[model samples]
Structure formats: C-alpha cells, structure tokens
Target: MEKNAIVDLVRSKAEGYFERGEFFCSESVVHTINELLGWPYSEDVVRMASGFPIGMGKSGCLCGAVSGGSMALGMAYGRKHGEPMNEKMFPIAKELHDYIKSLYGSTCCRVLVRNYEFASPERKAHCVKITGEVAAWIASKLLDDPEISQKINPNFK
Candidate 1:
C-alpha cells in the first residue's frame, strides 16, 4: 500500500481498537503499528507497553502514546545483538518526541490528560484521538523513510 493509504489504515485501526476498548493508549499504538507493518502479533510487545498507559502506570510520566511510538520505532530501527547502536534511530525518535511535544506541549501524560478523569468518556475520547494520531504519525515517518521501511520490511515498496 502507499504511504498515505497505510497511514490512513493505521489511524483507522487504532481508532477502532480504542473505541472497542480492546487496548489502552500505549498498547493500541504499538499493536496497531506492528499489525500494519505486517509483523506478527507480539504478546511481549503488548506486555511491555502495558505499563506505559495512564502515563507510566498513572504516575504521569511520559505519555503512553509517545512511549509506545518510541517502542515501535525501536522495533523498526534498533540495533541487533552484537551490533553497535544505530545512531540514525536517535533522530527519528527525537522527531517523534518533538512531534508529540509540539501537539500536546508536553510528553507527560498528566499534563496531557489534565482535568480528565480516568476511564471517563471524556478521557477515553481524548486518549482515543491521541492513540490514532500517534500511530498515524509513526506510520508516516516509517513509510517516508525508505531506508527504515526497507530495513523493517524488505518487501515494503
């Protein structure tokens, strides 16, 4: 699929997952990205991202979407065993952080969810939008970067 199409698909899927209450903010982002990228569904990835929701177990640290997006990026570009860290991944991660920060003014979930009650309709709606937007943003970045896309999926064209 084309990049824009893939972005749309990912966004739609993320939104669906959120609306269905199938996953939390972070889980939705990571799971949707992996699904869209044709990666096998990973229980481990979902487990790892579970704590990221509600801002690092509701401690109000980094936004769950941001953390999940970072993990997705790492899955795509992180170094393998015995391989040195890939410096290129840093800029991409930074860009993701900057984009989220630009949108919400902070990467903190507490700041992002300020005044919203947990599991309330208002909070769910807000988080649903964040999950979709973050997933789409990561999809766009991955599709636009040929090197990263090819690295992640050799058949990605």
Candidate 2:
C-alpha cells in the first residue's frame, strides 16, 4: 500500500478504537503506532499510556492524544540505556506539540473540550477526531522520513 494509504488506515483504526470504547486517546495512539511499527515493543507497552487519558486522569492538563503521540515518537526515536539520545527526538516531538497547539490554541484537554459536557457525544467525537488526527500525523512522520522509518522498522513498507 502507499504510505498515505497506510497513514489513513492508522488514523481510521485509532479512531475506531476510541469510538468503540476500546481505548482512550493516549492508548489508542500508542497502540496504533506500536502495532503499525510491527510491535517493536511488547503488547504491554500500552500500559504506560493508560494514565494520560482525560488529561492525566481528569486533572485536565495535557491533551491525552498529544501525550500518546509523544509516547509514539519516543517509541520511534528514544534511545536504549547507555546510548546517547537520538538527535531527532526533540524536534519531532516539538513538531507534534506545535501542530496540535497551532490547530486548537492549546494542548489542554479541558480547554479543547470546555464547550461540551464531558460525557456528551460531542466531546467524545471531538476527542475521537483529535485521536485519529494525531495518529495519522505520527504515522506520516514515521513513514515519510526514510531515516527514521528505517531505524524504527526497516520492513515497514
């Protein structure tokens, strides 16, 4: 499949997972990216993203999708113990943060969904959209950058 096609698929799956209540925002992004990257981490890897939902467990701080996207970036670029940090990690993560911030003015989940009731369909749909968008954005970053793609998953194509 074409790279864009793959990105779209990732977005759809991430959205579906959240829309179906299978996972929250951060978990959806982490799960989708981890799966797409061919399970570089174990299945238990998603556990780390569990607490980020509802803006850090309803504290309403960072957007959960953004947090998950950062985790996905780490999966791609983070270094192992004793290895120097990957040079591209910070810039790529900043790009994800800036991308969402530019679109919504804030990465705060409370701020983004403030107009809708927390339990309302509107809020869920809004979060679902953000989740999918972030997943697709990360998918594109993973696929388009040959250097990063090769490093993370040489068999991605």
Candidate 3:
C-alpha cells in the first residue's frame, strides 16, 4: 500500500538531509525539515540536539527519527523533559509518538527496525522511508511555523 502523501513528503525531506551528513538523530531532524522546505542548513540544530549527548551510534537505542523529531519539537517549543510539562507537552509528545508508531510500529531504535550499525540492509529503503516520514510529520506539525531555537536545557546553554 502507498503511504500518506504528507508523510511521504516529509520522509523525502528527511532523506535529503540524511544524505548531507546530518546523521545525528535530533539535529538531523531540523536539517531534514528545513532542507525539505528549502531552509538553509545551520549548525545550531546539531548543537541543540547534541545537548543531551548522542552516542547511540545508530544502534536503535532510541529510534533516530523519533529522537530527531522529538528534538525538533523541543527546539521549536522548548524542552519537554526534566520539569513539569506546562500542559502542552505531554499530549504533544504522545500525539507525535502515536503518529510515527502507527506508521512504523515501534520507535525503539533497534526493535521496530534494525539500525545501520547492524548492516541490516544496504540503503534500506523501508527504514529510510519510516525515518524520513516520521521526521517530516514532526516538522509539519511542531515546526509548522518555523520558530527559532532556544536553549532547551539551561545548563547546556
């Protein structure tokens, strides 16, 4: 079956960014979204998602696409963890998760689908599709207006 049009749109966007060495999960998300929408590439996206440390090595510890989308959301709306969510975060997080998981099943890095680290498939088309679409959906929703990034964690700022 063919995928949703919007989902596919975002997926394609994510893939283009991935091709450009935007490998880190969280920052790659911003790169994917912006590049998809014709926005300029910037290092700040990488700087922000890297705030939490991303040593997962593409092992699927947490789905890179999911982590990327989550980071994108955080970058646009402020961080969601380490404090009481101010009424808009929890639902948004769940909603985002539901959107991606419904399409891809599980979001666990290694479980829903294997990671590149495992060499599961060379240029795995389906995995790329899932990750890309997930990132696009996140950008379409959370970053629809394209706000500037803020320090998600104060100490990290």
Candidate 4:
C-alpha cells in the first residue's frame, strides 16, 4: 500500500471517535488502520490502548493518543519497549515520537493545548479536532511518509 493510505481510511473514524470522547480515540485509530489494511479489527489494539490508558491518562498526564500511537507502532513491529533496542525499530519509534512531539509541542496531556481543560462541548470539539489531527498525522507517519509531520506543526500557534 502507498504511504498515508491509512490516513484516508482512518480520518473519518478518528473524527467520529473525537465526537464521542477521548476514550475511543486510540481504538478508532487502530481499528481504522486495520480496516484500511484489511488486517482484521482486533482487540489487540484496543486492549493495548486500554492497558496504557491508565499510565497515559491518569487524570490527563501523557497524551493517550500518543500512547495509543505508540501501542499501534509497537504492534506493527514488535511488542517491547525502551526506544527500539534493535536498531531497526529504533528509527521507527524515534521517528514516530519525534514527529508527534514536533507537531503537538509536547505529548503531555496538560501541554497539548490544554486538553485537560477540555470541558465545554465547544472546547471538547476543539480537542477532538486537535486529537484527530494528531492521530491522523501519527497514522500517516507510521504508514511511511514522514513528511506529513509538517502539516500539524504546533509551533504554528
């Protein structure tokens, strides 16, 4: 499949998940990608996201979206940790994290444009937009074309 093919497939689902809430964001992204690639929408992705959600969203700590992204990235290569000790996986995870950080300014939930305060429906809508964009960008990069990183540049704010 061509690079970014996953984005087109997952964007709508990601947006829909945004409309719902933060809890579904990771599953939407993973499921969308699986459907897009015909890989069978399995619980592994959702479960992995759910597993990390605690460490990630302990009252909005780290970006759960990134954690979800990391989970998906890990599943694609291998289920391990420590920034890719295998040299090959190193570039993948590093590239994913670096790309996300460059776009979101910081993967921290509190810093990613105050997602912690995403209370009102209007504010939540904005959060959804930002999160969907971040998820899409993450999906895009993992699919291969790292250049999509420029599209979300948080510095633009």
Candidate 5:
C-alpha cells in the first residue's frame, strides 16, 4: 500500500480500539504498532502498556499515547538484554515526545484533557483522537525507515 494509506489505516484501527473500549490509549497504540510491524513482539506485549493509561495508572503524569508511542519506537530501535545499546532509540523516542509536547505544551494527560470532564464523551473523544494521531505518526515513522518497513506487512496494499 502507499505510505499515507497505511498510516491512515493504522490511525483508524487505533481509534477504533480506543473508541470501542477494547483498549485504552496506550494499549491501543502498542497493540496497533505491534500488529502493523507483523507482531515482532507477541500481542501479549500490549500488557506492558496497560498501566500507562490514565497517566501512569491514573496518577496523571505523561500522556498515555506518548508513552505507548515511545514503547513502539523502542520495539523498532531498542537493544535487547546484554546487547550494545541501540543508538537510534533515544533520539526517535525523544522525537515523538517532542512532537507531542509541541502540540500541547505538555505531555501530561491531566493537562491535555483538562478542559473536558473525566468521564464525559468529550474527554473520551479527545483521548481517542490523540491515540489515533500517535498511532499514525508511529506508523509513518516505521514505514519510512527501510529496515522497519521491511517488517511491516505489505498486505496493507
């Protein structure tokens, strides 16, 4: 498939997962990215992202989508145990973080959704939108990198 189409598909899937209550923001990104990359990590890898929603288990710190996006970045760029550190990991993670921070002035969920009531549709809509955007951005990044793109399913076409 073309790059934009793949990105849009990923965005739609992530938003659907969140909107359907199948996963929260962080889990949706992790799950969608993992699936997009042909599940290099088991789908169970999504468990690691679960606690990230609601800002570190509801403490309201970092945005869950940002956290999940960072984890998705690590899946592509991170080093495994005892291996030499992967140099690309940190910069890419920071790029996602900065992209989010630039958009909202903060990566805090509480701050980002402060204008909407916690359980209101407005708040859910806001989070769902962020989840889709982050998932799409991660998809673009992965597809643009030759090595990572090789891992993505061409069935997206």
Candidate 6:
C-alpha cells in the first residue's frame, strides 16, 4: 500500500481501538502500528505500555501518545543485543517528540487534557484523536523513509 494509504489505515485502526476502549492511549498506538505493519502483536508490548497511560498513571509526565510513539520507534529502529545502538533511532524519536510538542505545546498528559474530567467521554474522544495522529505519524515515517522502513521490514514498501 502507498504511504498515505497506510497512514490512513493506521489512523483509522487506532481510532477504532480507542473508541472501543480496547486499550489505553499508549497500547492503542503501539498495537495499531504493529498491526498495520504486519508485525506480530505482542502482549508484552501492551503490558509494558499500560503504565504510561494518563501521563504515567496520571502523575502527568510525558503524553502517552508520545511515549507510545517512542516505543513504536524502538520496535522499528532500536539496536539488538551485541549490536551498537542505532544512531538513527534517537533522532527519529526526537522528531516525534518535537512533533507532539509543536502540536500541543507540551507533552504532559495532564496539560493536554487539562480541565477535562478524568475518563469522561470528552477526554476519551480527545485521546482517541491523539492516538490516531500518533499512529499516522509513525506509519508515515515508516513508509516515506526507505532506509528506516527497510531496516524495520525488508519487504515493506
């Protein structure tokens, strides 16, 4: 599929996952990206990301969407054991962080959802949109950057 098409698909799937409350923000983004990439879904990934929701369990650290995007980036670009860490990985993560910061002016989940009732329908809807946007951004980067895409999945196009 084309890059835009894949991004659209990922965005749609992420939105669906969020709307259905099947996963929290971080898990939703990571799982949807993996699924769209045809990668094996791992419960480990979901479990690992669960604590990041509501801004690190509502303590309000980094946005879960941003954290989830970082995890997705790691799955795509991180170095394996005995291998030097991939130099490209940090920049990609930084790019994602920058994008989110530019969009929301802050990466704190509390800041992003300020004044919204916790877990209210409005809050959930806002989070769903963020989840979709994060997934779409990652998918777009994977599809557009040949080196990164090939590193993640040699057959991806």
Best by TM-score: 5
lDDT (Cα, tens digit) per residue for candidate 5, span 9-116? 999999999999999999999999988988889989999999999898998999999999999888898887899978888888888988888877888999998999
lDDT winner between candidates 2 and 6: 2
| Clash pairs (backbone) in predicted model 3 | 11-132, 11-133, 60-109, 60-110
Choose 2 or 5, whichever is better by TM-score.
5
lDDT of 6 by residue, 51-87 (tens): 8888888788898888988998887787778999888
Off by over 4 Å in 6: 40-43, 148-157
* Residue pairs that clash (backbone atoms under 3 angstroms), model 6: none
TM-score of each: 0.88, 0.94, 0.61, 0.66, 0.96, 0.89
* Superposed Cα RMSD, model 6: 2.6
* Candidate 3 Cα errors over 4 Å, as ranges: 1-10, 20-25, 34-42, 48-55, 79-86, 114-117, 120-123, 143-157
Q: How many clashing residue pairs, candidate 6?
A: 0
Question: Could you tell me the TM-score of candidate 2?
Answer: 0.94
Across 45-145, the per-residue lDDT of candidate 1 in tens digits comes to 77888889878888889988889989888877787799998887899899989988898788889888887987689988888888888999998888777
- Candidate 6 C-alpha error for residue 58, in Å: 2.1
lDDT of each: 0.81, 0.91, 0.55, 0.56, 0.91, 0.81
Provide backbone clash counts, one per model: 0, 0, 4, 0, 1, 0
True lDDT of residue 24, candidate 6? 84
**Model 6 vs. true fold: TM:** 0.89
Total clashes for model 1: 0
lDDT of 6 at 10: 83
Which pairs in model 4 have colliding backbones? none
lDDT of 3 by residue, 1-157 (tens): 1124544556665665555555544555666555443443365556655532132554446666666677565545555469665565566667788887787677675666544544444534555665677676764564334342221122210
